[model samples]
Target chain A: MTQDETMISVRNIGKRFGSVVAVEDACFDIRRGEFFSLLGASGSGKTTVLRIMAGFEAATSGAIFIDGRQMDAVPPHQRPVNMVFQNYAIFPHLNVADNIGFGLRKLKLDPVERRRRIDEMLELIKLPGFGDRLADQLSGGQRQRVALARALVLQPKVLLLDEPLGALDKQLREQMQVELRALQRSIGVTFVLVTHDQEEALTLSDRIAVMADGRVLQVDTPAGLYERPCSRQVAGFVGNMNFLPARVVSQDGGSARIDVPGLQTTCSISAERLARFGSDISLAIRPERMTLHRERPADQANSVSGVLHDRMYLGERTQFQVALDDRGTTIAVSSSTTVAERLGSIDPGAQVWLSWSEEALIPLGND
Target chain B: MTVTSELNAPAGADKTAFAGLRRLFFQNESLRGLVLLTPTLVILSITVIVPFLLMGAMSLWTQIGFDYTDDWSFRNYGIILTEPLYTTLLLRSLGMSMAATLVTVMLAYPMAYFLAFHVQKNKLIWLIIITLPFWTSYLLRVFAWRVVLGYEGVINTGLMEIGLISEPLSFLLYSKSAVIITLAHAWAAFALLPIYVSLEKIDKSVLEASADLGEGPVMRFLRVILPLSMPGVIAGTFLMFIPTVGDYVTAALVGGPDSRMIGNLIELQFGTVDNWPMGAALAITMIISITMVGLLFMVLSRLLKRWVAA
Candidate 1:
């Protein structure tokens, strides 16, 4: 997005609490109406960055611009952003309508107008006839929806969510994820979500910024992040990536031939993903990208023979751990249940050949 | 010979009896709970319930010239209702206690807030420090207040030394304000405990949520923090007001004849006037008034909760 279209411009933001650095110099542009997520594990400083943007925290160094205004001096109340806290933070003393209408008091709308807007929000959150219910009466999922409505009612320039679905169970979390996505689409408001769940970030965000050790490792589209991570850290964090020690054989204009010592095979990959290192590199591939075969295939250019170390059935897919002959290390290979059924004696102790296209191997230099 | 025969009937019978007794006591949950509570229940009845029942019965009798006659009448109550002396003292007691409650709770709330929000480590130490003065005897504390608020006491003497006053302020002691002030200081710890607990129980995120929702500090306090802490405020108010209403020691120590409350009058009736029924009646009247005020407060608090929520 262009600079003019950027809703939040975080310019080299750094935060420190006394001696410990919580977030390094992080910089990113969140586009207007974009669902952007800061994905990381615990202590990755994603929430700290979100808090800084919301003005609940002041960055020790650097500046933040929201809708083209410097937010360094602006307090949380004056900022054009609202947050749904992790615990929902619904006022136990206030009922549903009061909680949603909390921020709207600044507008000083007439009673009827305020009531209409509150009811509209209740309807949006699918809580009809729940305006009078106190917060204590609502269930966890209901509380979450109310918290969303409370923030969304203000129609702020941006909505910041700090692990909003972290407290939910597996089934409810998935349901809320879908509902949250649909709600964002309907509102067309820019959303900045901070979560430790990589799957959640990938599923809900238009752009995901993977963070590690208080640093923004990479920011990319979900598919791009999954398919072509810039570093081994980002690739490994986003999904199950198997790494094999490799060396660059040669480099052409558009592709690079890499030699994998562990697999004892040489494969050519797109030069665009070639890491900036000497010859030593690490070849990373997703388990689902590599296929298992009954015998060595003559047509396949890249193939490695290995013994099946373990077999795991995961409903629709089956995972196979293969121990390569050249290197005793095991690599996980996944296939659809149908493909696994076609392979004879799909059990441990069976000999299998693992094969994949050259594009499946992402060259991440020894991280 | 018959008794010997019964005793020797069956040794198994005694075993069966013991087994049944054990099962009856252990298997029945409610019964077991009652048995466990029996000691406490008996002690409470003897120390509290029996005295309360006797006081209620005595309040109905009349004292006829040093002899308490069980004529079963509300003559003592009728006298208290009709006498201007009794009525004024009761009203003054209620008014002073109300002022004391308000002052104590108001003063305690900020200290409690400080403890809850500002002090991070050694919270128990801070709490103990807040209540350190209360560890002293209540009467001793009242005497200490007497030393502070007396005509030639700490406040007046200190002011005089600073050349802020020409003479010791006579109004500082032997007045209704003096008693109120003493009561407030003595009961401050009670107010602080509840207020601190409720304030500490408040989720920090809720305050953040309020700020995020576009409320500055002042408005946030008025709308969110203050309302959420009302339970504690109400509890503190009750704890101070209810007991202080019948407080005679503070008045006796620092108050003049003009500041004598219903408690002082009740004390006089029981001790000097030698009228037990009259004292009992006066005590009952104070309780009834206090109960009415308590109920009124409950209703008002309910309305306040609803109003804030709505």
Candidate 2:
């Protein structure tokens, strides 16, 4: 997105609580109408960055601009942003309609207009006739919807959600993930979600900023972040990445020849990798990208013979852990249930060969 | 087959009846609740209900000399209604109790809020300190207030030492305000705990949510904090008000002649006046008045909450 299209611009923002730094020198631009997520593990300062953007916290250094307006002196209430809190903080004393209409009171909307807006919000949240239901009486998912409606009713320039679906069960969470994405698309409002759930970030976000240790490590589209992580940390955090220690032999442009001790071969690394030549780098590959076969695959460029150490039968896929002969490093390989069934009776401790294309090998930075 | 079935029917009926009885009395929630409540109910009947009923009966009897006449009448009620002294004392008691409740709750809420929100370290220590006044006897606390508010007491003596006043303030001690002050201090602990509990139970995220929705500090407190804390406020108000209205000690100890409350009159009737029936009548009136006022306050608060939310 262009500079003028940036809805929220975070400029080298840093936050410190006493002696401990919560977030450090983070800078990014969230585009207008984009569903952006800050994804990280706990204590990784993702939520802190979201809070700073919402003006709930003051950054110790740097500045934040919402629609090009500096938000340093703006109080949270005055900022053109609203938040769906992690706990779904619906006012227990007020009914659903009152809770949703809380922010509109200051605007002095007429009674009929207020009712119309509340009804519109209720309908938008798929609770068309639940305006008078007591807040405490609703179930968890219903309360979440009410919280969303409450924030959306204000028509904020950006909506900040702090682990909004963290309290939900797995099935409900997945369902809400799709609903949240659809809701954002339909409204076309900028959404900044902070969550530690990698699957949630990948599913809901248009672009995800992977954060670690109070800093933004990488910001890219979900597929880009998963397919090509800049460092080993991001690669490991995003998905089930198998990292094998490797020594780069040589480099031609962005592509490199790397000697993977576990794979027992000099593999051709993809040109997309940014690692330097003759350096100790790590070869990372997604579990699903590698396939296991009982016989040696003559056509494959990268292949290793190993003993199948363990096998787990998931409903749709079977995960095989193979212990390579060289260095005795164990690598995980996954195949679809149908494929595993076709190659039947591949027992643990049986000899197997793991193979993948050269493009499947990802060269990651040592750190 | 018919004879055998007929013979077995009675035994089957008996088994079902026993099972039904067990379910009704033991397994059922409502019946089980009643059964569990029986002990407290019996105790309350003996300790509270019996005395109240007897007092109600006695209020109707007239006491002549040293004996209560068997002839039931409304003589004491008539005296209460017609006599300006009794009516004035009752009104004064209500006003003084309300003043004490208002002051106590106002002072206690901020202290409770501070304890609940501001103090992060050694909260148990602070709570114990807040309740430290309760360690002393209630009468002793009243006496302590007397010493502080006395003509030559702490305020007057300190003012004189500072050369701010040449004479002791006579109005500091034996007035309605003095009774109110003494009673509020006596009930401070009671007022603080309930309010503190309500404030503590408030979810911190709710405040943040309110702020995120564009409410400033003052509006946040009014729209969120105050409404949520109303239950404790109501509890604290009644806790202070009910007992203070019937309190005789503070008024007797610090009140002037003109500041005598209905409680003092009731105490007098029960003591030197030897008019037990009249005292009983006055006690019933106080109960009825306090209940009426309490209900009115509760209804008003409920309406106020609705209005505020709207």
Candidate 3:
């Protein structure tokens, strides 16, 4: 992206809390008006990165810039960024209107304009006439909306959200996710969200930075990260993937032939992933991509015979755990319940065949 | 149908009777709570309420020589309102108590803040140390203050020995400032604990949120910390002020003739003056005035909160 497209640039930022290294040499650029997510598990330092960007924390090394202005000397309040805290931190003593209008005080707006802005924010958050209600009077979802309104009312260049929807119930969380994405799109504000929920990140983020142990493992679009994870760790973290030990037979140009001992077949990997990580690699396949059949299909190049060890009936899809002839390896295959019904009564102990296309077998870096 | 209705009537009556009794004493939470508090109510009525009512009754009667007359009159209250001695002493006591409360709260606030925010370990030890002075007798503490402030006492002796002063100062010991200082020291723990509890109850995130919203440290404290800690401040004020207003021992020991407060006058009427009715009237007046001042402070603090929030 060009300099104008880059809204916030975090450059080689590192933070150490006494003996613990919270964030180590993290570098990334958030594009303007993009919904970006730092996705990680707990202790992955995603929140720390968001805090540093917001100027709540000063990096022990390197620097952060917002709109090409160095933020090292700026305090959080003075920075051109606002944050929606995880707990929503609505001032309990103030009514909803005052909470939303808090940042407006620093702007020194006239009463008419301030009221107009606050009312506009309340309406945007779907909370008209809620200005008179106190913080304690608000429910969890209401508080979340109020927090969003409070931060967005300032119209900062960038808005940071630290697990903004982590506190809601599953249903409310899903609904808010859709609403939040729509809100971000309509306002065209760069939203940098920190979350451990992969589904939430995948659904809401335009681009995701996968973090682990205070290091950025990969930065890609959600589909790119899920479909073509650069490392085995990212693949495992992003979604369920069955790994089978594979040996590279040959490599030419961008394609490589790999032998999967568990599947008992040599499949062509249409990518040069084995060259960088060497011959000892794992063939990763999503469960849904593998098809299960009772009879061996004649045209299939990659197929393995196994016995169904377990069957899980998930409402839309049924997952079957298959034990191959190889002693201790089990691979899961998921099929639509409609297809399972047409296949006619496959018991747990029944024999099954699993097959997939060559493009489904992704050669992942072992490291 | 008529036979079935008649058969159900006795069972329904029995159920209603049991439910009524249960609702009165057990089913309703407030009524159950009142039932559980019966013992405390009885004890308080006997020990406090009965004596207070008797005192109020006595305040309207006249005391003649050794025996008290049964004639009920407002003569004691009239004397209290008309006599300059009673009014002056009451006003002096009010002023001294207010001064003591101000000094105590101001000094205790920093200590409470330190204990709440800064101290990470040995908090219980610090709390115990603060209350250690209370373990000593109250009279002993007053006397210790006397020793510290008296002529040729700790302050005078130390200053003179160091060649800072030519002679011992006589004004330090027998003065209103001495009484105020002693009362403030005695009530420090009372003021500190309530303020500390309030400050400790403040969610740390609220302060961080304030700072994040563009408020500096001073503004954050004024907007968040002070308002949130108001309950403890009010509690501490009442804790220090009400008791100090009626304190007789400290005034008697540290205060000279001019610094004597209404408590000393009440003590004189009850003891040396042999005027029980007048003493009762003075006590009643002190209680009423203290209660009124407490209510006024509460209202003022609430208004201050609203103003600051706005």
Give the TM-score of each candidate. 0.95, 0.93, 0.94
Candidate 1 clashes: the total is 0
Per-residue lDDT tens digits of candidate 2, residues A137-191? 8989999999999999999999999999999999889999989999999999999
Number of the top TM-score candidate: 1
- Candidate 2 vs. true structure, TM-score: 0.93
Worst 10 residues of 1 chain A by lDDT: A269-278
* Residue B117 displacement in candidate 2 (angstroms): 0.9
Candidates ranked by DockQ, best first? Answer: 1, 2, 3
Candidate 2, DockQ to 2 decimals? 0.66
| Per-residue lDDT over A1-367 for candidate 1, one digit per residue giving the tens place of the 0 to 100 score | 7777999999999999999999999999999999999999999999999999888889999999999999999999999999999999999888899999998888999999999999999999999999999998999999999999999999998999999999999999999999999999988999999999999999999999999888999999999999989888999999899998889889998988888887778888777666476688888989999989988888556888899999998999999999998749899999899888888566688888888887788888677
Instruction: Mark the 10 consecutive residues where model 2 chain A has the least summed lDDT.
Output: A269-278
Q: Clashes in model 3: which pairs?
A: none
Regions more than 4 Å wrong, model 1: A252-255, A270-272, B1-29
Better of 1 and 2 by lDDT: 2
Model 3, B50-161: lDDT tens digits are 9999999999989998989879999999999999999999999999999999999999999999999999999999999999999999999999999999997999999999
